[model samples]
Target: MKKLILLLLVFPFFVIAQDLPTVYPFISEGAKYIDREASIALEINILERDISTGNIDSNLLDFGLEVFEYYNKYGAISEDVYFEYLEQSEYGDSWLSCIVPDYVSSTLKSQGNNSYNKSNLGDRDPRTAWVEGADGYGIGEYIEMRVYAEALKDLRILNGYQKSIKSWKDNSRVKSFKVYINNVPVRILELEDRMGEQIISFDDLLPEGFDIWSAEDFEIKLEILAVYPGERWKDVCISGISFFGCYC
Candidate 1:
């Protein structure tokens, strides 16, 4: 009887421990041991103030909630590194706008006056998206960007047309992306078909002995390998792409 009770008590813990990697692959296993509640709370407060004063839109608020959800579900350590990255922004050591790529790939001319340019990928507005202009579902199409890789930590992607629920359902979303850093193939990211931001960590992929303070730059490319077909259109869309890191 005592053995049965012990097994019942330990089963859920074992399950969760095994499931963390599958659930939040962006969070490094090493970072799952550090606590950063105070830092996370501070960022939450800043986000709240920004949202209230109209300084920033509610997208950041939703981001904060997602971060809080990570903290809640995986405990304090799960998001400690992320919040640590955010803390640098407070002291001017980092800035959010720095995540915007210096240059983005060209868009197709057939997009017309709707302005479906590649620049929309980093505009921070979910309503806008970068649509691939290619024949037959744009299977081999890709988008590339150039950015300083000094403090780059993680990349966040908002998949599909996010202008409206109807639009999202009508446009294709990426299922697999072959990631390249400085033209060197690095990782293949598998994204979910659902809405909202998907984060991919670059911590483990950085070059050995890399220094964040250095001024090295890299060209990142995301080549679409597969997609979640849309209901109405064959266009594959991506709403936003942002990074989190420390510039200091």
Candidate 2:
């Protein structure tokens, strides 16, 4: 009876280990990806097509090429690439302009000495966040932040805490999300669970470029379309969110 109980306890782990994809061994030096899981995933993702690459996220695809190129002895492109965030060009990184008041009407006050709050979002710290404990799958939760830049070009969102591996998976996080620019519907994207970080490009991508920065109250709103529940907490959280654009 004890032996049967032990087998039952360990069976799931044994099955999970087998069910996991084969982690192909490869090395990279050019693009030091933030998430090791994403690095290995990228290796499997690109190599599956005979190293020819295919329809994948452009940033990930670029990182793969950088690693491939570096491995194949390409130019001196040291630290020129990363998969976790977009390498902003033409202008410096965008700043946290301001948040539209009505959307973030209810601010979650800090608990004890723990410093996770809405204000931390603009502090430029991925370790901090504003979380809501509504119990539901984070639907109806949203943020409308002003993109205060000379030319608001793009938006980037980093879902969940990415300061550490344990913290990331320990809290509920966004899965599918929606975007609104200047109160106008823009796009919807399904985020990658392996420490999601995605950039939405508007220049040349949107019809007539959807330039809303010139508008009086230019705001970018993100709503929780769906969520992935945490292991120990029901609260939905976002580690970091950024705006990339021209200061000029």
Candidate 3:
């Protein structure tokens, strides 16, 4: 009985190991990317086309791509990008501006987190809506990731500019915002939602190496939860993404 139980317990491990593929070792450098600009957003495309196994695991289609800022020679800053919140219109229509064409198709639905399970990390539960929506009745779902740049300057954010975010006024919830310089935590400015076009003030000051007189650090990362409430999930569509900064 003891040996039988042991075999049963180890059997699943073998099964899982068999289920996982070793052919496509994770290519970390190629998988990771950086965009140095005033405002930059990234999109990651995940698919289950394992050339080794003719089978595809649609459930493993979701993954997180982290962003970071480097400072000096030994410091780094990073954060997990999260879904922001959205509100319905006063007339009960889903706020359309918050909806982008890139994520507006029935082919896919947003997966909540890295697990690719139905659970959402933040308030909004992104959809795992059927790949075919309700039309096909029982087909699976697909999803894509999208990020948007919120500014038109040098990708720099000032503490004073966050004052326009509407969520700041509500003391009831913890607004998600973070920043770092050379791995050191920096203060993030909270603002009202209406301050969308506001720019951070540096007074012509850049980081130490940038200009001898510059006081603010030039290489820094500011992270904020961009989507929330309605859902962290995004529908997929084909179109060019628009941002407020120059693209390389």
The models' CA-based lDDT, in order, is 0.64, 0.55, 0.25
Cα RMSDs, all models: 17.5, 18.2, 24.3
Candidate with maximal lDDT: 1
lDDT of 1 by residue, 105-184 (tens): 44555455566777777665666788888876777677777767667777778788877778888889888876666776
Backbone clash numbers for all candidates listed:
0, 0, 26
Off by over 4 Å in 2: 1-109, 204-209, 213-217
Lowest-lDDT window of 10 residues in candidate 3? 235-244
**What's the lDDT of the predicted structure labeled candidate 1?**
0.64
* Best first by lDDT, ranked: 1, 2, 3
Q: Give the TM-score of candidate 1.
A: 0.59
Candidate 1: stretches off by over 4 Å: 1-94, 98-113, 204-215
Tens-digit lDDT string for candidate 3 (12-88): 87675334211111121231111212122221111112212334333322321121111112232221222221122
Candidate 1: Cα lDDT at 24: 27
Query: Which scores greater on lDDT, model 1 or model 2?
Result: 1
lDDT of 2 by residue, 1-248 (tens): 99999999999866753342211111222322256445545644444443343444454543444545553464322332322122321223344332322345244556797666676555444556778645465687787776544666655666676655677777778776666556555455566565645565556223355546665546666667778887876677776666556655
Better of 2 and 3 by lDDT: 2
TM-score of 2: 0.54
